[model samples]
Target: MDCEEARFGLYALLDDELEVSKNLEILSHLEGCPTCHRELELDMRVKSLVQAQLAAPAPSPELWNRIVRRIDQEAEVARRPSGGVAKWWPTAAALRMVWGAPAIVLVLSFSLWILHAGQVPSPFVEELVQEHRGSVTRKRGPVDLPATDPAEIVRHFRAEVPPSSPVPLLAQEGARLVGGSLCHVGEAKGLRFTYEVGLGRIVSLFQMPRPTRALPFWPRLGPRYIAQSQGPGVLVWGDARFLYGLVGELPQEDLQRLASRMKGI
Candidate 1:
């Protein structure tokens, strides 16, 4: 399979939505072509970020049906005429009086508010969970910059990231740095460090410059903030200059301990 073919199937592959044969074909292509493999990882990261931001409790189907029923009832009431002079009718004058400019303005304002409320932004740490699930658990090869040595990874990131960013060195026993990759936590650019923490588990560490705008639902910088379990455990904490996160299938306590041992937090 070529890169274009692989790109078309990347999301399906990540979601396990494709047939087994087609999945194998794309995996084979990815294994052979580093560029396409990296493309797959990028797709994974982007999908993660989007799912995090867009995730919200959708209005139930029953709720929508109820809304439709209520609207129909209101329309029926508006169309009906009263038995006496005091009764209501859908007269042109009455319609104009009911839906005057002020009423129209109120309806428009309410619609806008609903639109804004439905788009509530999610925390960046959720994105980290998805990033780890996709880039580490789902697929493991073809990092942007591959290096086992901490210093070498540091050198690569120094050139790729800003000067203020200091990459952490993993010091936990049995955990070894696999490589590094460029990733996006929402719209902000970030770096991901891949690590193998033994027993078939992987940990992904993400670091990026602090966002200028406050992210909704993110904890203040100080102690580690542990997010609710979402497939993998996520731990997030930030300093004045940068934000950091760790994602793994390991227990939350283990992940937190791993984060604490890192040279830089």
Candidate 2:
């Protein structure tokens, strides 16, 4: 096997999940390959340390009896016939875990990748698109409250960008931060920071490097503009010559008000 494939397999081998034949094949490869031999040695040392630490745990005899009983009970359940159907009913705790929303979401996120499996972008294109989505927490998901006062909002946002980066200074007079996310913009990652102002409306913030925007960028389309979705307004502008698209629910007058607040034009 190739070194890269073998390196990935080494962890599974250490875990003893691969077949004996596959392990022998990997060992043969590792024998001839000095690089792989080094990797295997490292993995062996780490595994031995972990196993030694794990082996230190000693269960009490009473707890061991309970574990044995539980295992036997599970085995009996597996053997029993449930109304002539194959036996496999979950215990009560398992049912609760199965129905939990967070668990459902975790499973769905993994499945969602398969559902959206499309043409994988080339490395060049992959390098261009930005991933701006942030982690979703259990309680509030990803959105966060925006600072109402312009000075505080400026202080907050400035901290996000690096000192050497070309992000514009804060000029959002009346807008409040609603929530924000990082999103992909063509080939580059952009920050999708959203703001809400008067009348329960939203103004989105898009931040991206100006040059790497999609195929049809500036001069042909626009330097900066606003778009709407589901009644919410989005303001797209460029900073340090980068593109930023702000999207949220709101009116036209307020939306432009949100847009013009930045000096980037």
Which candidate's TM-score is highest? 1
lDDT, residue 197, candidate 2: 44
- Model 1's alpha-carbon lDDT is 0.73
**Tens digits of per-residue lDDT for model 2, 1-265:** 8898888888888789899998998888889899989988898998888878653546654576556657877876776776654444665435554666586697789878754552342343212112212322223333333334545544554555554545443257655554454445444544555454433334456676667545354566645555555434566665445666555554666657666776655
lDDT of each: 0.73, 0.57
Candidate 2 ranges beyond 4 A from true positions:
1-162, 168-172, 178-187, 211-222, 228-231
- Candidate 1 TM-score, C-alpha based: 0.46
Residues 1-265, model 1: lDDT tens digits: 7889898998899998999999999999999999988988888889899998664756755576556656766876686664665345455445555656687688889989966763553244345434554563243323366566878888877876887677877789978777677765556677888787755567888887877766556446344577756567888877677778887777999998998898865
Which residue window of length 10 is worst by lDDT in model 2?
Answer: 124-133
Look at candidate 2 and tell me the lDDT of residue 195.
50
